[model samples]
Target: MRIESVHATPGVSGFYFDDQRAIKRGASQDGFAYEGDPVTEGFDAIRQAGEALLVEVELADGTVVRGDCAAVQYSGAGGRDPLFKAEEYAPVVEGPVADAVTGREAEEFLANAELLEELTVDGDRLHTAIRYGVSQALLAAAARARRTTMTDVVADELGTEPAAEPVPVFGQTGDDRYVNAEKMFVKGVPVLPHGLINAEEKIGSDGEALLEYVEWLVYRSRELGPEGYEPRLHVDVYGMIGELFGAPYDRDEVVDYFAALEDAAGDLPLQIEGPMDVGDREDQIDAMCDLRAGLADAGVDVDVVADEWCNTFEDVRAFVDAGAADVVQVKTPDLGSVHRSAQAVRYCEGTDTRAYLGGTCNETELSARACAHVALATDAAQVLAKPGMGFDEGFMIVENEMRRTVARRERDRSRAAEEVTAGD
Candidate 1:
């Protein structure tokens, strides 16, 4: 099948983009907005509405496939691309992007995605958002052209088996940690609340606040969670732990503190993301390695997750190669093309490091759904439920999409079995 035309539209993302640098500097939250000056170069304000560029590719049969281009909530931090402004990028999608894919064979996805990912405009690569969304549309187009699910398209191209069941979904609790966590326990999310403990105040000056929160989280899960409910506890500190402990991450005190956190969580598995930023990628990796080694030495059963400096595919490899993290987040948008996320996830197959097929709360339904296909196709350890901090909507979209894909694959398998019986 050949592509007919391409269209682009500026739209709103599910969440706001915050200047991570400003937030780290102790920007106070006033209502939903922050009261501080923007610290990132492209950010005009400390917080602004997130934007998405919607790419629609019309196939030859008049069927249009869609993808949403979005950036992370904390853009321009951790070596990510600058903030994504949909209005500024819509023209690029309509012009060179459209020109590149138009009239090309739509039945194959990998080559087209690679071509678009490497395409440069004005002596620079297309913004990561553009590459993300366009690649999603192309994947959808390939599935449509072949009369298959997007999951199957990805699996076939990448030489992997599609997941037989839904990937475990991880829920985020934003600032409403208590209430949203209740929702997750009730819903039986495999990974419980992603406590957004991103600031010094949130984690507490001495980290007492976080310890208390972990204890409460464990207690509440037993109190309200359904029968046989056991979920992993993941808290993203955004590097506040590093700030509090003042690294040389293998210090006796730091190891003791992690042991305390494990004790607070009782028996539930614990994973901490971005324990310390440390400003540079190499330094961040070294710090995480030191922390992991320390935890092992102290016999603390805690998983250190690498986030911050691990933005690109190369960065993920670096972390995985050194065994810096127990889990490495394959932040989808930061990786540019969707296939890269799949590649990153599969890369962890033989390593001690596991892939958390993660993205931001700022993505759209289209992007989230596309990632659902990727997660299942790659059989990732856990897939983040996202597009917003609100627990219900993101979970429903991702979980339902994976369920539906599984149902369809099952139906196909049964039909093929019956056909073989009839022929025999």
Candidate 2:
């Protein structure tokens, strides 16, 4: 269907609630930390606040599809900066850019990456934010038109199905101490301790605590027995490993860390995400491959997952081609459009490479729905639907849409089967 009109609703009300803590870091007001650090760093703070983009797309059929683009604040500090910043740019986008997209065929608008590029202001995060919001709205509209769930749309777009088993997911927890891998068996997912692996907070940098943590994780998994567990420990290096352990550390130190991690993990698998802030593309790939190789040498079969480094289609292609990573962490905003993101996933199809739907800490229902569509479309092995978990809104919208999509798909499949039976 053709996009009749694309506009932003007026009254950019704040979604902020008092209970939410800002992701920004500062000392007490009037203190040295506050003096040196501004309360907001524009887009940088926005990335942390987990902002939502509210968008409306009107189709020729008079269907007005409205949705939000949930932007994740990777920095993990919670605040309203991202939302506030997105609001600031709403006017410009709703005014001109929306006008530009109106009356265009939805498929055409989505296909024209070049035309969409003209609507953006280079390097402006708001531009990125607005573009993301619009893309999400259009995607929702398309899904509505097809009378299908976003996931089904995505599945049709990309040929795949849910893994025979749910793929395990891991994230960094608060303590540098990695959670015992056995916890994943109980939770039905992988647990990568987050707080423990912060680049700046190297409390356990010597590898002693990390090793112990891994051992506990592995031992617990073994205790649970094979049927109870999926053998894999997930880690988020978050670019710090590259910065902190760069050439200065002897290869032995690196080898030691992987060796210990492997020994602790036992027969289970290990997947490392990050080392994000590598110096260059080639360097990033090299580091990932090197780490993967190191772990393998230690008898730890591991898969390296990429985040920041795998930001675009080109990035995905590069990582896959170089054999630098085994899995691609797909984030909606990182690829800008659901279609483009789906294409990126398609690119990885049939290869040894796999894709996982990564979570944006701050996601709204609309954005989450769009992401689900992408996940379904791309047949991502796993997805994170933690809507409003990190932010105030929680998962209401995302959960609702996810349910709707699944139900719709089931009905469609059942109807097709019935049609075949009736014909016979």
Candidate 3:
């Protein structure tokens, strides 16, 4: 089968893009939007409607495969690409991108994805969002051509088995942390709420607020969760802890605070993402290494996740090789192609670092579902339920996709077994 045509369209994402620098500098929230000018270059407002480029590739058989190109919620920070404007990118996709894939064989997903990664229009590689979406479309197109599931295509190419069951889905609660967390416990989400404690105030001047919040999370999980429902408590502090204690992350105060957090959680597993953003990649890794070592020495069981400055496959490898993080969040958009994300996840296979296939809430359902297939194929430790902060919508999209894919694959395997038995 061959690709008949390729096209691009502008669309809106599930969430808005916020200037991370502005937010970090205390941009006040005004209702759903931020109430200040953007501090990041390329951003017009502190918060703007998230944009996505919809890549649609039509096969010769009239089947259409889709993928959404989207950036992170906090674009233009942490060494990520600039804000994704669908309008500006639509022409590129329709012109050079379409030309590249238009008459190509549709069954070679890995090769096509690699070509797209190295594809350049004007002496510059395509944006991460473009590569991400185009790779997703190609993967789906390959599956359609082979009449197999996308999971199967990925597993075959990577020499890994597709997950027999759904990967654990982690949910994030925008600012409605308490109510949404209760909802998560009730629903038996394997990973509880990502308490978005980004600001200093949220962490408290002396770090009391975060401690209080962790205690509350433990209490509510026990009270509301189903029997045998001990979910991992993951929170994205966005470097507030680092801010509160000030650098040299292995300090006595930092160790004591993490110990306190662990005690508060009782027995629930706790992982903190982006504990500090020191504005440099090497420094960030060094700090995380110190913090992880300190926690281990103090007998604190909290896991430190690396997010900021860990934006690419190379960065993930650096962290894994150095033993800098307990969990390395493979932020999908930041890595450019979905296959790169898979490689990053696989890179952590025998290492102490666990790969959390995570992406921003500022994405589309198509992108989120595509990531679901990647997580299952790579056997990531946990996959994030995302596209929006609304606890239910994002969760439903990702969880359902994984469940349906697994079911279909299992049914196929059973039917093949039955056929073999009949042949015998």
Clashing pairs for predicted structure model 1, backbone only: none
**For residues 232-251, what per-residue lDDT tens digits would candidate 1 score against the true structure?**
99999888887788752435
lDDT of 2 by residue, 1-424 (tens): 8777766643322222111122212123232112233343343322233445577777888888876654444421221123335556667667777767777666543453335645545544344445566777766765676776656555654555633222333432433243423333444444443332543444255555555666676666656635665545666655545544555223445666566666677776766666444545677777777766766677656566777556666778888887777887776565666666777777777887877666564455566667766665565655553453222132334435555666666778799999999999
- lDDT string for model 3 (141-176, tens) is 999999998888888888887678899999998889
Model 2 TM-score, all chains together? 0.76
Off by over 4 Å in 1: 247-250
User: TM-score of every model?
Assistant: 0.99, 0.76, 0.98
- The Cα local distance difference test for each model comes to 0.93, 0.56, 0.91
Clashes found in each candidate (C-alpha, N, C closer than 3 A): 0, 27, 0
Candidate 2, lDDT over the whole model: 0.56
Off by over 4 Å in 2: 9-48, 60-62, 75-84, 106-126, 157-187, 190-196, 200-203, 216-227, 243-250, 388-404
